[model samples]
Target: MILLVVQTLNGFQLGMLLFLVAAGLTLVFGVMNFVNLAHGVQYMLGAYLGVTFAQMAGGFWAGLVLASLSAGLFGLALEWLIFRHLYGRSDLDQVLATFGVILTLNEGVRLIWGSAPLELAMPRLLSGSFALMEGLRYPVYRVAIAGLGLAVALLLAAGVHRTRAGMLIRAGASNRDMVSALGVDINRLFRLVFGIGAMLAGFAGVLAAPLISVEPGMGENVLILAFVVIVIGGIGSIRGAFAAAIIVGLVDTVGRGAITGLAHLMLTGPAAAKVGPALASMLIYLVMAAVLALRPAGLFPARA
Candidate 1:
């Protein structure tokens, strides 16, 4: 029971980070009808900027603010310079171009930060642990991360469902041409969505910096998981992304532990060790496949 609780909490933490990244990616994909293979770059930028700014400012809070703003601005610049030009191109062109951006930026990051992994010091306020039960003491920082993510998710949900900007975003997602005909500056909306998406991804990166190593290419794996999230949740659906992220996170984390324990019961020790991890790694993909097989359009498709 204690182990289950701990693993579940860990899953939630991972899910929260995934949600932050996937939320933005889904918004951009839905609103712009564009595939951005380079979305991970913004995440990498966030972590790097968060660490640099924090070190320079000598304060974690200040660094987070500065890094988020910088990330948003950089995203805007990318949209204006590269993404805007590709809006009308084929998905193949968009994918190829953005993939180039990924390669360029990855190399740029290597040149700037070198190949060494960097670490962000945890905030002083959250650098301890608290007892969650008689036998379990959980890290305060992890709880804070989960709390922060939940807060952000709530705000995002409200913004999408209640605000006029959100309504415009929704309308644009449903039919960009129609929204444009109705006098909406679809291009401006695209920029706004893209910028917001980038900022959210950056925010995730900042939050994750302390927990994981900040290094070049760190965002690639997260990006793949985020893609799985958006796909499983239904492309362009924020709610779907949230649910899917949590599902993926839990399956990936808890499944590893659970599957391994079960494997030990059924197989030799060495075989179980090898097979357990391999099966656990495939859990999320299998879930995605199941969801797609049933829903085809995803659980919460934007149109639905």
Candidate 2:
């Protein structure tokens, strides 16, 4: 029971980070109709920046601010230099161009950071575990991370549903042509949307830096996972993203542990050990496949 509780909490933590990253992805895709394979690079940039700034500032707090700012600026610059130009192009063009950006950025990072994994130490204030129940103790940092994610979700929900900019964003998503015909400065909206997406991805990267190895290609796998999240949640639906992220997180974390144990029981130890983890890894993808098979439009596709 204690083990289950702990794994559940860990899954939520991972899901929260996924939400942070997927929120941007879904929004960008829903509104712009553009596919950005380079979105993962923002996460990478954030982690790298966090490492660099942390070393300079001697702490995580200041480093977070500096890294987030840098990532946002970089995102905006990329928008100006490349993404904006590709908006009217085919999805294939966007994909290829963004893939190029990914290659350039990855190589650039390797050159700058020397292809070595970097890590940030958790802040002193968040570096321990707390009693969750009579027999369970949970890591303080993980809970804090979960709290931060919930706070961001609330803020994002409020921004999307209650603000004027959000209304414009929704309008753009529902019908870009109609919004543009209404004389909305759709270009400005696109830039803001893209910048926000980049910032969120960067923020997620920085948050994750203390928890995982910061290295080249770290974001690539995560990027694929985030796409799975958005797809399952319903592309362009923040609510869907939140719900699906939690689901994916739990299924992924728990499936790995529980499925392996079950396999060990049902098969020879050696075979189980080899195949169990492999199944666990595929578990989420299987879920994604099931979700798509059932609902091609996703669970909460942009309210349309």
Candidate 3:
């Protein structure tokens, strides 16, 4: 019971992280009608930036803010240098170009930071555990990560649903030609959306850095997960991203624990242990496939 509870929390925390990354990816996809295979690298860069800022400023909060800004600026720079040109290009071209960017960023990080995974220490203020119940305790930093992620989700929801800027974003995504016809500078909107997306991805990276090994190519797996999340949540829908991210996180985390336990019931220790993780990895994809089969537009698509 205790193990289940803890794993559930862990999974939820992971889901929040996934939300951060997926939010940006989905927005960019919906609004720009552009495929950015290099999006994962933005997350990677955020982790690296967090590491640099944390050490330089000698604090976690400083690091978080600086890392996010750096990541946003870096993304903006990419938008100007490469993505801007690819806006009207073919999907194949965008994919190829972004993929090239990914390759470049990956190698650049290796050259700059080396291939070893960087370690980030949790902020001193949050480096302890707190009681979740009478006897159950959870890491404070993990709780903080979830809290921060949720706060971001709420802010995003508010902005998208209530703000003029978000309205424009939605309008641009749903009907770019119409928005453009109305005198909206579609390019500027694209830039803002891309920058925000980059910042969100980076924010996720910064938060996860202390929890996971800070390394190159780390974004690749999470990027795939983010894609699954957006697909399940519905592209261009922040609400859907939030819901799907949490669902994916809980499902992935709990499935691993449940599968391992179940395998032990049917097989010997070694075989159960070996097969448990494999099945767990496939669980989310299975769910995604089922969701797609039933609703090709996702559970909450932003557009028809």
Candidate 4:
């Protein structure tokens, strides 16, 4: 019972993190009608930047703010230097170009930070564990991460649902051509969306740094997961992203334990141990497939 409770909390933490990364990616996809395969690298860069800036400023908060802003600016720069030209290009071209950017950035990260994984220092205030039950304890930092992520999610929801800019974002997502015809300066909107998305991805990275090893190509797997998130959530839908992200996180985390236990009931311990994880890893993809089969637009598809 205790293990289940702890893992559920862990699942929520994971879901929040996934929400942060997927939020930005979905926004960019929804508004720009562009494919950005390089988006995950922003998350990777955020972790690296957080580590560097935290050491330089001698504090975690300072590092988080600076890294997020830097990530946003970096994204804008990429938009101007490379992505702007590719906006009207074919999706294949965009994918190829962004894939190249991934290779270049990964190599650059290696050259600058080296290939070894780096760890971020947990903030002093969140450095201890708190009892969740009579015998179970949980890390304060993990709780903080989930709390912060949820706060961001709420703010993002409000911004998208209530703000004028958010209205434009939704409008753009629904029909960029129509939005442009209405004198919306679609390019500027695209830039804003892209920058914000990058910042959000970076923010996720900063939060995840202390919990995971910061390494080269770390974003690749995350990028794949983010894509899964957007697909299952529904492209161009923030609400979908949020709901799907949480569902994915909980399913993935809890399924691992449940599958293993079930396997133990039917197979040898060692075989169960081995097979459990393999099946667990497929749970999210299986869920995604199931969702797609039933509702091709996802659980909460964007309004067209």
Candidate 5:
């Protein structure tokens, strides 16, 4: 029971991280109509920069802040130099261009940091666990992450629903030409949106850095999962991304943990061990497939 509770929290943490990544991806996709495969590289950049900054600044918080800023700035530059050109191109062009960016960034990381994985030490304040119940304990850092994610979500919701810029973003999502006709500087708006998106992805990487190895191409797998979240939740909707991220996170976490246990009960230990990880990995994809089949438009499409 304690194990289950711990796993549940881990799942939630994972979901929160996914939300950060997917939210940005969905925003770029929904508003700009561009498919960016290189967004994941932003995440990789964050992790790398966080580590580098932390080493330079001599503190985790300073490193984190620096990493996020650097990532956002890099994103802005990419938007100006690369993504801006691909905006009006076909999906194939977008894919090809972004894929090249990914290749370039991945190689760049290797050149700067080498191929070795860098580790970010957790802040001292977040290094311990707290009792959640009489018997169950949870990591304080994971709880902090969940709280932070919730706060970010609320802020994002407010930004989207209350701000004039957000209003334009939504309008652009539905009809870019119409928004442009209103005399809005669509190019500038695109730059802001892309920067924000990049920052969010970077933030996710920073949050995840302590838990995972910061290495070249670390963002690739998570990027795939983020795409799946966007597809399941709906392409243009922040609300959809949030919902889908949590669902995928929980399903992936719990499914892997529980399936192995269940398999052990029904089959030999070796067989259970082999099957558990495989099945757990597939669970989220299975859910995605089912959702796609049922609601081709997605769970909560942006209000079109």
Candidate 6:
């Protein structure tokens, strides 16, 4: 039972991280109609930069701030140089250009950081564990991650609902031509959105750095999951992202942990071992397939 609880928390922490990455990807797709495969590279950049900054600044917070700022600035520059040219192009063009960016960034990181994985030390304040129940102690850092995810969700909701820029963003998502017709600077808006999206991805990377090894291609696997989150949540809907992230997180985590246990009861140990991870990995996609078959649009699509 305690093991179940710990796994549940771990799943939620992972989901929150996915939400951060998906939020940016969905937003960029929702508003700009651009398919950016390179967004994952921003996450890789964040993890890399965070480790470097932490080593230089000798603190977690300072490293996080620097990492996020650097990633955002990089996004802005990319937007100005590459994304700007592709905005008016077709989806295929956007995909190709972004793919190029990914190759360039991945190689750049390899050249600068080498092929070795970088390690990040968790902050001293969050390095300990707290008693959750009898004989159960959970890492404080996981709890901190969950808290940060919730905070980000609230801020995103408020931004979209109450803030002027969010209003513009929503409007743009629905009808870019109409929004542009209203004399809004769509280019500038895209730049801001891209920058924010990059920062969010970077923040997720930084948070995950200490938990996971920072290495080249670290973002690729997560990026695939983030896309699943976006698809389940609905491409343009923040609320949908939040709900889907939690659901996917719980399902994936719980399924991975429990499948083998359940399989062992029915099958032999070797069989269970072989089948468990495979089945667990497919669970979320199965959920996605079901959702697609039923709704087609998504669970919570942005208001039209």
Report the lDDT of model 1 for residue 159.
Answer: 96
Residue by residue across 1-304, what tens digits does model 1's lDDT show? 8788889999999999999999989999988989998888999999999999999999888888889889999999999999999999999999999999999998999999898999999999999998877877788999899999999999999999999999999888778898999998999889889988999999989989998999999889899999999999998988999999999999988988899888888999689889888888888999999999999988898975
Off by over 4 Å in 6: 132-136
lDDT of 6 by residue, 1-304 (tens): 8778888888888899999999999899988988999999999999999999999999998999999999999989988888888988998889898888888888889999998999999999999998987877788998999999899989999998899999999999888899999999988888889999999999999999999999888888988898899889988888888988998898889888788777788788688788877888898999999999997768988755
The digit string of per-residue lDDT tens for model 2 on 1-304 reads 7788888999999999999999989999989988999999999999999989989999988888899888988999999999999999999999999999999999999999988798898888899988877867777988888999999999999999999999999889889999999999999998898898898889889999998999988889889989999999987888899999999999999888999999999998689998898899999999999999999888887858
Q: Against the hidden true structure, what lDDT does model 6 obtain?
A: 0.90
Collision pairs in model 1: none
Give the runs in model 5 whose Cα sits over 4 Å from its true position. 131-137, 265-274
- Model 3 clash count equals 0
Stretches of candidate 3 off by over 4 Å are 131-137, 266-275
Model 1, stretches more than 4 Å misplaced? 132-136
Task: Score candidate 3 by TM-score against the native.
Answer: 0.95
For each candidate, give its TM-score against the true structure. 0.97, 0.95, 0.95, 0.96, 0.94, 0.95
- Model 1 per-residue lDDT at 240: 93
In candidate 6, position 258 carries an lDDT of 85
lDDT agreement with native, every candidate:
0.92, 0.91, 0.91, 0.91, 0.89, 0.90
Candidate 2, residue 231: Cα displacement in angstroms equals 0.5
- Maximum-lDDT candidate: 1
Runs of candidate 4 exceeding 4 Å displacement: 133-136, 269-271
Q: How far out, in Å, is residue 90 in model 3?
A: 2.2
User: Given candidate 4, what's the lDDT at residue 280?
Assistant: 87
By lDDT, is 1 or 3 better? 1
Residue 3: error of model 2 in Å? Answer: 0.7
